[model samples]
Target: MAIQTAAKATIYRMVMPDHICPYGLKAVDLLKRNGFEVDDRWLETREETDAFKAKHNIETTPQTFIRGERIGGYDDLRLHLGKRVRDPEATSYRPVVAVFAVAALLALATSWAATGSLLTIAAGEWFIAFSMCTLALLKLQDVESFSTMFLNYDVLARRFVPYSYVYPFGELVAGVLMVAGTFMWLSIPVALFIGSIGAASVFKAVYIDRRELKCACVGGNSNVPLGFVSLTENLMMVGMAVWMLVKPMGVGVGH
Candidate 1:
């Protein structure tokens, strides 16, 4: 009964000995999920796939057609179905949000396991430390890209290009030191310095200059926006640095 009411859709996909188009499978799945009665057509050879493309005057395969109207590829089909498609070039905080979320969960889990409690002063400390380390690792993955992105708004990086390369390593060292509850003398200064610079840069870029751009916080190849998330990261570092410095002197709030 559901099949009788389903929309008729046609899909042309590649299926060969050495290659099978993943998009074709995705298209088929999408169609089925959206109550489409799909007429799955396969181009069984490379020549056949190329010929199909030439015949349609299209560059790629895994094409979908609905009721004799070409719906294009997997992304195009999604758009036709009114599904939200993420644009690669669009600014987003999703990556940063995911990183922080995972970091917080890890902190909570570890704290609970060690101290037999979910909420602890150490949990908050662990969250910030882990988040910093994770973000640094991401930037280190492609430092060239990260440096290029960092230079856009960072005043220090702009003046001294070497600072861009050094920033991730500094963050990593500071985070590791804080997590281990050691080397406050070294970690405090590094975190304070970088966090201060970062906060100023973000404030100038987003609030003062009002120049919209992608953040280099997660890495060079991210679409994270240069605003609140970036500021938050810097603020967290600053807070952590201050806490670490004061805790040893018996002047801080947390244990």
Candidate 2:
């Protein structure tokens, strides 16, 4: 069933800065485009809003209220919009892309393990490793983070250690095994399980701990909340593993 979202009067504001101010304008434009009547009163700060906030412990501007219900900040606002509307399609990947992505992940893991510095690994020296992992997973999976997911004994060590020792090495091993499919269908399942662990680790550290931190998962440039995205990604991999088990595609030489 589709979740019901509350009808809301939105307040989009940013602090004094032209660049930031445009975000509010853009939001107003989008909301209006979507058929919601844009009330300038909601956009502008009024004595009533100020008094409402003062009475109810609101200290932030650009705060949204739906018939007197508070709707937090920009991120919350965006999420609400996503729920209410659907957009046009962009690019769609063919199945071949997933195959290529898996092969690339395996190659990266193998190369990094050979002659790569432990610190290089710890510093997450292999950019290809993360790229391959993300691509193979369709930019869907994560290798868990600290303080966020399962917070076990294994997790504590990851926080203080370097990347080389943590993910890349293990990832390299598992990734290679996955591509090889040497152990029949076992390889993919094993890799998926390991990758799921990694995803959980990253997700836990970011969202649960509220750490607006960089994911040293691949290298950098991956800074998303480790929540539903992480879970969904792993679930996809799990589905792949099941497919491999049912239909073990004999390793074919890539042309």
Candidate 3:
């Protein structure tokens, strides 16, 4: 529609000497983007802002008015415009689910190319190893963030601190060695050490202490829940480590 024909919106926001309300700018931009001509009103002082809030019976700045009707603040403006917004605190397993799903497909492809079969012991082995590498990649993206989250529930990380920084590198190294099927001595120890500590920490935090927390399995910023899934990841590492360690003997085993 033409600019003159667009709907009109009036927004009252705070733009004081030392502080500007970010949501006010967002509300104005949102209105303009959605075929509305915005009248951006600024309260330049604390007294003016407080008076506006008191008069309108609202608690926040960036209060929007559409056709003389109150439309609330930024988040409320989005809802008014029918925009889909995510709930930041809602639990989600999306990250781990995507990583594991892609890892499974990669393992199947690798197995088909190597042995002309998808359902094989090597495929299963590759799946676990690929998952480790994929999960490690997420952590490696932001080591500081990953370490901060790791310290929340990790036994060694909480005490040693530096261990949190070392954990992702350890996982990556072990994963690469497992894939190559070489350097078993190095890979086995790294996996077992980290895995045992992780499993114990998770069990203590969730099962014993009954604390509800987010899992750092995928990454530091992930919303994946800390419970069975996290425990399973650590257990998988331990299982892979033990199996690879014993495969050399006549009993026959593999990652």
Candidate 4:
């Protein structure tokens, strides 16, 4: 019986005196990681690179081939290997999903460590608080930009411009206070106010006005769509606020 060898791929990439194609290096790394035997070819000069491009009728370097068939550039190669290719302008929920997912994990982990239980009322509260803090941090990264994007849809923020600038801080304060469980009087009200305004604004913009926009829930520069995820965030805050309001203020303090 003959022994089988790894799959083979051929890549032609630029490695000039002043510039090396980063995609070329990335392509090679991907091939190696996925158990492909790569034949790396370099175009060491601009003339050589241009000639190769003309011959192949391609516009970019880091051109790849599989089994002697031309497979286009780095992104194309990624598709061939069943990898996700990100579109820069496309709307997505990945950032919001990631924030919520990590927050839930942290809450669960803390619950288990502190009380030897993962699914407690405290854990649920912590999850919302953590999500609020993380989302606020993202907005605070570029408050100016976040506020600008925020005013596009937020009814209260547009009416009171300063509120746009202060929104992230309010969220952060509410979240921190909720976690500490010492200032429920302040935190619960802040959470209710902002969350109510946010939910109303999002509903009017997306449902009533039928407008298309990006969400500032994660950040201003984020490509997340202004829809379900945005509404969910505000609703979560409101729900947490109401829950804490009904429960004892000292219930989860320092837990």
Which candidate achieves the best lDDT against the true structure? 4
TM-scores for every predicted model: 0.92, 0.32, 0.68, 0.84
**Against the unseen true structure, what C-alpha lDDT does each candidate score?**
0.92, 0.46, 0.88, 0.93
List the candidate 3 regions with Cα displacement exceeding 4 Å.
1-84, 248-255
Error of 1 at 126 (Å): 0.6
lDDT of 3 at 120: 75
Backbone collisions counted per model = 0, 18, 0, 0
Clashes of 1: 0
Model 4 residue runs over 4 Å out of place are 1-7, 14-22, 33-35, 42-59, 67-69, 81-83
Top-down lDDT ranking: 4, 1, 3, 2
Over 77-96, each residue of candidate 3 has an lDDT whose tens digit, in order, gives 99999997679988988888
Give the TM-score comparing model 3 with the true structure, all chains together. 0.68
Stronger candidate by lDDT (3 vs 4): 4
- Best model number under TM-score: 1
Candidate 1, residues 1-255, lDDT tens digits: the string is: 444577899999998888899999999999999899989999998889899999999999899999999999999999999998888888888899999999999899878877788888888889999999999999999999999999999999999999999999999999988878777789899999999999999999999999989999999999998999899999999999988866655321223
TM-score of 1: 0.92
Query: Which pairs of residues collide in model 1?
Result: none
TM-score of 4: 0.84
What's the CA error at residue 75 for candidate 1, in Å? 1.4
Expressed as tens digits, the lDDT of each residue in 189-243 for candidate 2 is 5556656665666566655765544333322223433344444444545544555
